[model samples]
Target chain A: MDAMVEQGPEGSFVLGKVDDLLNLARKNSLWYMLFGTACCAIELMQTGGPRSDADRFGMVFRATPRQSDTLILAGTITYKMASRIRLLYEQMAEPKYVIAMGSCANTGGLFQESYAVVNGGDLFLPVDVYIPGCPPRSESLIEGLMLIQQKIEKEPWLKKAWTNTKNPKDPQIEGLL
Target chain B: MTSEALIDYVKGLLGDKTKWADPEAGDNFLTVASEDWKNICQTLATDKKCSLTYLRNFTGTDYPEDDEIELTAHTFSYSEKHGLIIKTRISREAAVCDTLSKIWPAAIWYEREIFDLLGVSFNNHPDLRRILMPEDWVGHPLRKDYKQQETYRGIPTTRPA
Candidate 1:
């Protein structure tokens, strides 16, 4: 439990479990990789812009996958781009999250019948959240980010590693390998 | 000169090599034998009157019933402010045509696109590789009788239906 043991004019120190503190830090600063392939990218940019201001929640865009803790797929996934997506995902650090934004990334949407487009990102990626819209509004994208925050708060990162438990969302990874 | 005059000029230059198609509404085009395609395009590009210096568009169409594939090139001249459409039909069983990239460098990627989607081979093209599809992609997706593959590199190409 985290509690203030004493009060002072300068500041008060609080005691808490390392896991809670770590989760708190992680949930607040989710640096998402700047990756978008289609129209949903516009919405993503707007969400990061002043109007929606994703920065208010400590979410910011990172230029490289190596520095990002989250990936927001903001458009269609073509067969030619599938391997490239996998390569980027593999380059990210551990405890990474994936948000499949817009209808195209969710189920290939209107392009489901296309000869070259992949049906959905989940067919190859272990997506953590799905935002539904032809191109989801910025508000919904923020809500999706909050959902990821909630997920991060609940994860017992150290305990899971000690227990040797695997994430349930990794079946697609198994098939890919 | 207008497109009509340009077409007539091209007809005069290519003579026996060109077979003029009846102008449909405002669209005017001529069909040339596959063997004479390169020489005719050379003439149209170099000839003083028909200086077709710009290749506006290059594409192909499959005619399954006719057992042939038609390759179309739309050429325009900035100096003359005129354009003409030249087409050539090749046997479907062996869909090959001479590359016009030598005359119009813009035809390089256009030819690659046609080759990628329509399965038309451009003989002697500098770099005739798939431009839109992956290297290992099975069949031409735009062919009339093309069958979508079940999977591409282990990813399902079709959705659950």
Candidate 2:
């Protein structure tokens, strides 16, 4: 199958492993949910804007969680918002990813000692990539999206579906209703 | 108008109900008894001479050393362009104060926020509930001695050191 691309008539046909083809399609069009709870959300918007041009990497913002492939938690997660965040995560389709896109979302940032703020988004959601900044610059958020793209490229989607497997060390996030 | 004139105007209206007026400090607020708070606020808002019709800011502060919680209301008049600060102290154990929503409708949400953070209970705030914290939150977070609970609905509140 490796020689199929070279042997085929010019621009007529090509062949690749099913996993690679699927991953290729998945990595390019990562639809992130439009959710921002704090200051870092500004950077998230800037990343998607003209200068950072997140759309260039095939990343776009989805308004609802049901259609999103990525959840960028772009600010502080107070205890009150934690359950709502979990609900949003649960609503996202399977094979979804999370990018904790600021110091607050990463480790409660400045509000770490506050009575209301959750320590980090990882406490309630499985975070895929963490972008570190009080409010990370637009460039940093784009970098995080690129990291997610890289991560999607390596996932064996078909194999995992066939085995009915799950990610190892998935935290038990029960009773958050 | 100057703070002294404002204090004198309010004093002339409420008489002994105005417990003490401090015009020389940071806020220039008049401390009124909690029992007379509602009446005094009504007078301030309704009286043409001291028409403090707008509720500028309403907040509560917990003083652990004094064993009291002070509720302050900064009132302003759009037509007059003058403001007055009114304060009332409640025992921390009770933390109950009369609702000013009747005098100025804006006090409703402000009172709810104060209740949410400082544990102050407004006697007749129509819709009294938590405005900032979760409905099931354990304690008022703004209290000086507040201790955050370990977890909220199975989500840990603190990061591992």
- Give a tens-digit lDDT track for model 2, residues B1-161: 66678778777877777766544756666898888889888988999977888999999888999999998888998888889888899999988888988889999999999999999988878999999987878988899999888877777777877
Instruction: State the lDDT of candidate 1 residue by residue for A1-177, as single tens digits.
Output: 254567678887667677888899999999999999999999999999999999999999999999999999999989888888877887887888999999999999999988999888988888999999989999999999999999999888778653224456553332232
Give the per-residue lDDT digits (tens) of candidate 1, residues B82-131: 98889999998888899999999999999999999999999999999999
Alpha-carbon local distance difference test for all models: 0.88, 0.85
DockQ, computed on Cα atoms, for candidate 2: 0.70
Which residue runs does candidate 2 get wrong by more than 4 Å?
Answer: A1-4, A8-15, A162-168, A172-174, B21-25
Docking class of 1: medium
Question: A10, model 2: CA deviation in Å?
Answer: 9.9
State the lDDT at A106 in candidate 2: 91
Number of the top-ranking candidate, with TM-score as the measure? 2
| Fnat for every candidate | 0.62, 0.85
